[model samples]
Target: MGDHALALGTAWAGSVQAAGFIALPRRELTAALVERAGVLLDAASGTGDPAAAGAVGRWLVEAHFTHPSTLEHTLTVLGPALVRAGPDRGPAVLAALARGYAAALQERTRAEQERITAAAFVARTAAEQARWASEARFGALFADAAIGIAIVTAAGEIVEVNRALCEMFGRPADEVLHRSVDVYIPADDHEHRQTLRAMQAGELEHARLERPYAHAGGETIWTDIVLSLVRAPDGAPRFIVAMIADVTERHRLETSLRHQAEHDPLTGLPNRTLFFERLEAALEAGRHVGVCYLDVDDLKAVNDTLGHDVGDHVLQTLARRLAAEVGPGIGSGARAGAGGSGHLVARMAGDEFVVLVERPADRPDPAEPLRVAQRALDVVRRPVVSGPHRIVVSASVGVVEREDSASGSGELEKAADLMKAADTTLHWAKKDGRNRVARFDAERHRAAVARFELSARMPDALEAGEFVLDYQPLVRLTDQRLVGVEALVRWDPPGGDRIGPDVFIPLAEESGLIVPLGRWVLSEACRQGVRWREEHPDTQLFVSVNLAARQVREPGIVDVVASVLAESGWPAHALQLELTESDLMGTTGEPLDALPALAAMGVRIAIDDFGTGYSNLAYLRTLPVHALKLAGQFVTRPFATGMPDASGEDGHDGVDLEVLALLIELAHTLGLSVTAEVVETAVQLERLRKLGCDTGQGWYFAPPVPPAAVPALFSGPVGPT
Candidate 1:
């Protein structure tokens, strides 16, 4: 096509001779395969890797074979390029292209073979039956079968046999013919003898056994045998017909299936079905079974928020955890029952699980069950999450012994009842606080039933003596000075112990009574703070209370806070609203706009659990933030180990410690001071001091005791080292 075309072709021919092997793929195919072949060739020509330019050429050649039409088109385009290219470059380019095409053709064959095997095996029911029938007849047609075949007498005796049978028994056929079949059987036959006798007496239609048979050599060979009773015209027994097939492989598979079905698929622990079966047997023998019911609190929330796939990961982690606790018989002298093992755990359903323990039957006291329950409770309380969600879900266990089950009805029912009760107790644990485990208490059922009914009567209970507040002091770590008090919501039952916010707060949230309940706390805490300030004006006490995430976004939140300030005549700067990371994350942009308005009014916005949210720095910086309270977890290790918060290349100071430091610095740079929470030791204090931490709070300053203890804490020693 061009004046240099003849010269380019001549140069390319020399390269083919110089390089012993080279491939030529079509131009159109190469163009189709390579997103930018020209750019790839141009860039790779400068690379030191000799394979790079050749590899790309091979990739294009493979595409040509895959799409055959592209091959002709690609070659036509390539000819023009080769004709125009200067002599030296054209030869190298053509040589590389030659080898590439051949490699592609070989790869295509491998991909095809793999596809044939991957296609699903297809067979009709009749076809499968025919194949099995044909397979079964393979050995049956052997005329002179070396193994013995037999027909037993009417009385379950071996009455007839073949020449092979006589040889096997080391006796003449007549001498061995009438021998009793049971003579060669094992002593502890269990029910095998009955099954064989049933077949001989026309009771069992077919009975099979691979039982040991004694030979003339005084050795035993386990035989594969099937028994079938033969009948005369009037239904009288003639003799038993038998067929035998050696099945050592099939027997092994059956045993393996039994093992798998009994154990958990994930943890290899006994499943609920198998556990109950074992417990039933143990109970029948008057065994004292200690049962612990466990539920991983956040498995579902992890599944729902992150994904079910990740939730499965959490379950696996939990299984490993439970295994480590009370595993390997690590505690050599643990309490034991009549049964052999100490503990058995089972995953009953999603996130719900159970643990069964064997307690010493000799003990008059039932403290051993409690000890097991305590151990189980401790194991589950540890924080375990699949991926991003670090949730601590504790379990509640109801441990009841099978004291008097008639020793025959089975432990399964009793153990199951205990499991149900333990599950019931766990509901109360959730009521108490999600991370606390509760042991089953039968004596408290009446009170619990009342509480259950109270769910219906909560609105009325709110009007009654249900909710109140006791203030806890928020003190300055620098000096033993009272800066503010956090008002904790409490619910006092008519004439009993006050229910914690843990129990009733969820109830309030569920019933949508939090709006009223929260409103009441705001007004009450404001009124109380204003009253305390008036009673002791020199004190200048401020009130801080938890504001639910739902309240943060509500249009009425601003008005309520405003009304509280106006009615109580307390300064907004004195009151601080502590909202959790989730609360801030859940808010929309406009609802979040309320933050600026509140900050403008002098109500300080503190992001509680500062390091534990999904907020990016861009959004965090745009916030009307007055203070950033570090979560206890992020700085707790540094606090414990006396380590300065510094960065290293290998990345694990504390999850994102560097990022947090930057966040703190960013807040500082934006004219905001930061507070590090859970600063419990002097080392942590020193670390925080070095980090330029502005405020510190934890038990190190003062524990949250009674409201009356506040004034004493202010005057008394802060804490003992």
Candidate 2:
């Protein structure tokens, strides 16, 4: 019994410390607890005494183990301690001990309650005197409260009002007290009346909202109002308590901030963000949406000539004028023009603005956008006085309309795409002539997109080796002997048919991809030239590669040519570099210097598309010596005769043989060979030979063939040279 008591005391001390009961000395508390528990356990085990359990409970309460959990721990720990003390103790005895402990705890609770009731009885006698004073204090506080307070009866009549509520409503206490609550709310405010009815009917226990309150001064005061229900002891509804806090300043600030965010600061017009928001809203409502994308024509010139200050003034003035003419506030009462009240004019960005117009719901007119655009154009053409300068400006407008619900993208993206299409059409209007309105055309836009797609794919196509070269024979005009072949590039894109140079070459030049593409052509042509030279050693055929103007101006032209010749082991004399007439006519610097240097290295240079670009004969004579390939338009002019004579003694064909004769003679005088292009028939070939044309290239000789077909052409028969 002594050992079990000591162990139980130690365990109890540890558990109490763990439970944060650390006010007393641990050793004293543990020793006293163990002695008490041993005595209690002995009585309970020997006689099964309920008094022993009651004593244990009282001891627990005195030790300040008043927490239910602490009491539970005490009882739990005592169970084992009792078992240790009496080896024969059973569950029945433990149950009796639990019942006794619970009775003791209940009795302690009843005693505490009795003591509270006695204290309350004494307080009640004193509270009667304090109650009158507390009521007076409450009345004073209510009168002096910062927030407005009002008490209203269940019948919707104001029962009482504090000083703040009287001041808040600008009315005397007696005048406001008897009035209905409806005086504070407008009769047209059905929604507010419905809310009030719901609260009064017990449908709502409490309600809070920000609403405008009517002031006796004939102005509305915004307030954050809260209504709370008061109930009697039986839970029956009593008078309602209403509290109101003035929020007029906050509401004004919020409105001002929203205006600033949505409007352009300089022009006081809606900005792009708000314009897109309105567009999305209209689309969501499934309204027919139309927009006029307007651009200030030559506005950059105005900015450059005057200054940015003047430019800003011009934009602001223009914005005001456009708004007056095309916006909903135009003219007078009826919203002016066909736009009605469903229109928005916004400044998109620098030098660009847009006017959004929606068809009226009663009568939808598809042509209303055009009328809006015309009005905007008329307004833009008016002169604006900025500072001392009276600047006259014109604008171009592109209009597009959408009648279907938005698809393919979300609301914002669809609006963005619509604006983009409008901008594109606006560009077209500017291109045709500034200060005009243009409607979006599906075919033109589709063609433009196709061009963009082809241009986008050029670099990848080059990387994938989809580009290749085909050779067309440049034959001798006299005997039709194969003298040279012009190398033309073509794109054989994967999963698509062959794309011609006419399509992708110009695209390449525009995108500046021509530099590498031209390099590939030059290198590949030289490489193939070496193979042809080995096969046709006696023929002495040269390979020609046409060069774009940009490629000729590239910094490393001479080096590239030298590298290609060195790499291919092809003689430089057998490679001809063909340049367009404009390339050689007006050019200087790199091309002029590079051409002579290349000629000095024994590489021949020829002018392709001669008689085009109106080359200066005097200037042409100064370029390094070369052959002139006459443009195909000259020789292919509908030959009149079935056969043409080799001699020019008789003017046989309708072709201007006189001009051809003079051009050939001019070339010979300059010590240059002349090549005729498009010499298709025997008559044209005979006429070119008679005119002293040295070589000819046309479909009549052969269309451009693959490199594998070139060797076969070399073995074929040749006419007399």
Candidate 3:
């Protein structure tokens, strides 16, 4: 624990002292040299000597502190011997020797500290070395560092710069040292020191931005610089270290790459991804934004008529037109407000265009966004001459405006909502003959989505045993006696209330739920038909069931129908399949191949919704249709005047009278019986009967009731509702 024990600074001094001794010469030492060297060195200090000492004493004096142990021992022993020789010479020799050893110790201490610094520098990683924390030892460490690094003060002064920093700056580190960081910074960035100072002051601990710094030839080189604050443990500013890299090439490539990702090569506008990003950020930023989703309705016709090259030209023209309507993102402030501070335009996909506005003004009477949406619609509505084709492609737009806090991202919902609204409105636009803009309505969207959800769940409900057949008696048109019953599938989901097929059947077909549910209906209908036949042998008639498009399209539809018949032990003709126009649209994919197969199994196919689907009698021959059930639209409502017109065509002008005539005449021509749906009023029933309608199935006959109620219904008289 005394002076000989290891101390922080002295341990380093001791290590250096050892280093200095390793180089001491061990050449042939004559007794004369040792004695003479000792005498000369001793005499040089103060004592007179009889002879010279060896070179060891001189070596120790020259390279002071060299051979400290040896120096100490020799000085002690030799001084004593010299004292015996003479007091004057001995005392002075010892004093001179002590000074030489002390100087050597100081040199060894300096070397050890340098060695420690070099090792620390080498141990640092590449990233750390670039801007290592500044220390007084940095001067030595800087020279020893493998990568370039620099240190700057808050006032932008480059103090104690490193060699790597110099190499990065392409100048000598010393020359670069003490220069204002502004010397390397461009003039435009001179006022931007607040950023760096803030970082140094611990406001921002780190920052990375590429800026051009002047090099040796005044060559402005782009550098990717990471600046971080070197702070004391108490969090006060020590220095700012700029770990810079020459990223000129990397920057060039990255910029080139960013353009490729964010911009379209053809139109050079923001792609879908970038457009949505801006829309989402705008939404998140809580601004009033608007979006005009537009699609060129005529683009398909344009491509068909004028080749894709000219079609592309029209699209390019359309892009330019949109650009004129709404300014392209430009300038910093302007780019920040690119979509008009609240609006953005993007090609959602295909010929469809989406003009997005983030700032959807929440004013109940807001008109600016509406005006912009109208303008965008009008801008693209104009005719464009693409080469030889004068393509008159009008735009259909669905505009949606919502404020930032609109519940969700609003992009997906808004885009979909707008597209649907625009499509529905655009249909009127088309019927009114093209070129229009429409804003979205929440209620309409909600209604449609509700309907869609209802439809999509039906088939699954049926599979889960939620569907039951409700039988409505089909009475004899002449006698008012119940001949058979029509089976309607009803949904009564467990843990919920019951819903009629009217609520979900159409939906099931649209969402492809009808494929499975339709099979259920047919199978159950036939089973019920057989039960009725057993219950009332006198009422040995048929049961009619409705088929959806998805069911008709099912690959096993015919097999399912035949299986139902076999399982029910009911004749195929006793179970009638009532198919609407939507059903025929799907089944026609294979030329009525399924119809013929079902017909061979004695299953009768009746075309439901006949006149409404615009039936071309020429193609009806291809179907194995046993009967035609006129569409309810043509057989009901105010149009059902139920009177024959001058043409003797059963009042051939309205829903019931006129359409029924066309239906009956067409059915008679095809040797098929006609069943009028919804024959409610006596006038309509009598009209259909006169039109030679062979059978009637409607509320005019009986209302659908429970199976238990059916027995009571047929037990008595059954007639029009």
Candidate 4:
């Protein structure tokens, strides 16, 4: 192989002058050709593989030995030398080398043909004889090329088309030639026309675009087209040459993939990605927009009871109905002169679906969203039959509408804010009642947002000691003596404003923060009680703290209470826990069982707000209850004026003195002490005292005071105002 490479390398060097445009020096070029010859010889003798020979052929093309005579000259000089070195394998090697050279030469020739076609426009400006010669040279490539080609005059008239172009359009050559380009390309295509105008005006040398063309067989063919402007030697625009490749199948695959990405598979509706895209586009356009967010109520129950198959069927059916009802407007309104703007119904994961409606900025309809929501609920309520079972479902809808004028700049709202508002309204609909439509209410939404913010800040507020206790006196009705104080917690933020328990207690309970917050309140109240006892040793004023229902149900509540009592050194007997009548009545199982243990620890259990709940007086006797604090209504109702009684008598109070008298008597019989709440006037205090109310607390005696103020009240018996 070494001796054969040297002889072949010498022959290759001899052919370099005829090969034309040799890029390398004589020594380097000789060495590269000798190495390639060695590889070919080795493969032919040992492995019998032709791939090595093919690689060498491609190397020659890359090394710029591109003249038509290069391959012929190479074979003529080296063929006999190779045959002499390896006679048995020499013929096979020669065949492989010829095939590789032809393949590479063909590819390079195709690329060069395209370049010469582009150069034809400039060449046509030469002498008439030279133009004819250039055309003759391009004619062979134009006739045999696989890609479609067309030559159009500057006025967009097709002067000629190659056989490939005619075949691409499924037409004969004469039928397509001499026709206006508009016969194939649509005149109404603005982008294509603009590109052509730019090229014809000498502003652009070339442009590439993908467009659809109509075939002779009445099918659309997607084509990747390259348009090159042929200009005169003076740079004046001449004819245009277009090279086109059919991309129909590739375009179809791309379209299918994009559809799968943007649409729900089961329902075939637009997914959240496409929905938000259209929403943001609408908002950016400054259109008045409406959104209806719908959630299928109890769809999970269908999946759990029947099967996921049925659940899928239900979702698909609902999606179809919503799209059919709402999408007709979408297509027509998307056009310029349509009556409406547009609408899009999309599936937003699981049982959630969202509908976006766009309206023109000149006309805004706030009630349109509500109507759409109602229509959605109506359609969803229709029964759907899947397999052998029929399923009925309802949807809760939240509707939001923003007027373009509201923003003063034609932009109605942001997409994110609109969606969030719609979601919040949907929650409101579900919360108010299922199968209902809830329109966005700014006031109610603001209050809910404020509650959420306050709830989120509660843990930090509690950690910072922002919570404080205010004592409301629980007085004795008989002697008008200050007997106890109900401990009420207040939120005093750094801003120096106090928030009452009514505003934040429910928030704490909903967020599960009440467990820790209640524990803190209990510990603080117990500590305050110990301080009061030390300040006034003679007075045995019990401190009453209201318990939230959530706190009562806590697993370690009894332990928490015991720990607080033991830590504060406050007597359990003097620390009263008040539970709302409803909370105590609802208590059962462990929560109810825990009550006795608390009572055993000497803590008094009183039912606060008595008669407000549907209480079984007989059931109250079974519990370890200490006292009943009559609901404020019972005290205020007897003296109430300007109200009708249950019997509808005008100016007669709802409850007279008799009802109050009977309530106090019933408490005595149950072995329960009674406390009359909200004692305001001297007359009411006298009436309660006459009714044998054991204790009372009202402004008539003294309003709730701080711990320091309580000692002053303890200095004397309190009298009615």
Top candidate (lDDT)? 4
Which of candidates 1 and 3 reaches a greater TM-score?
A: 3
* Pairs with steric clashes in candidate 4: none
lDDT of 3 by residue, 449-551 (tens): 6776776666566668988888877766665666667788788888888887677766775677777777777777777777777887776677888876667
TM-score of each: 0.38, 0.74, 0.63, 0.74
lDDT of 4 at 647: 75
- Residues 354-455 of candidate 2 have per-residue lDDT tens digits of 998865566667877888898899998989997788999999999987742234333223787788788888989999998999997766876777998999
**Regions of candidate 3 where Cα sits further than 4 Å from its true position:** 1-211, 214-220, 224-244, 298-317, 328-343, 358-365, 378-392, 403-435, 495-497, 553-556, 580-597, 609-611, 615-625, 630-674, 681-694, 713-716
Clashes of 3: 31
- In order of listing, the candidates' clash counts read 13, 0, 31, 0
What is the C-alpha local distance difference test score of each model?
A: 0.60, 0.75, 0.62, 0.79
What's the lDDT for residue 20 in model 2? 60
TM-score of 1: 0.38
Candidate 1 Cα misplacement greater than 4 A, ranges: 1-149, 155-180, 194-226, 231-237, 245-254, 280-286, 293-342, 347-354, 359-365, 371-417, 423-439, 443-453, 456-506, 510-550, 553-721
Task: Show where candidate 2 strays beyond 4 Å.
Answer: 1-144, 160-175, 214-220, 329-342, 403-413, 534-539, 553-571, 585-603, 638-655, 716-721
Deviation of model 3 at 235, angstroms: 17
Query: Least lDDT summed over 10 consecutive residues: which range in candidate 2?
Result: 116-125
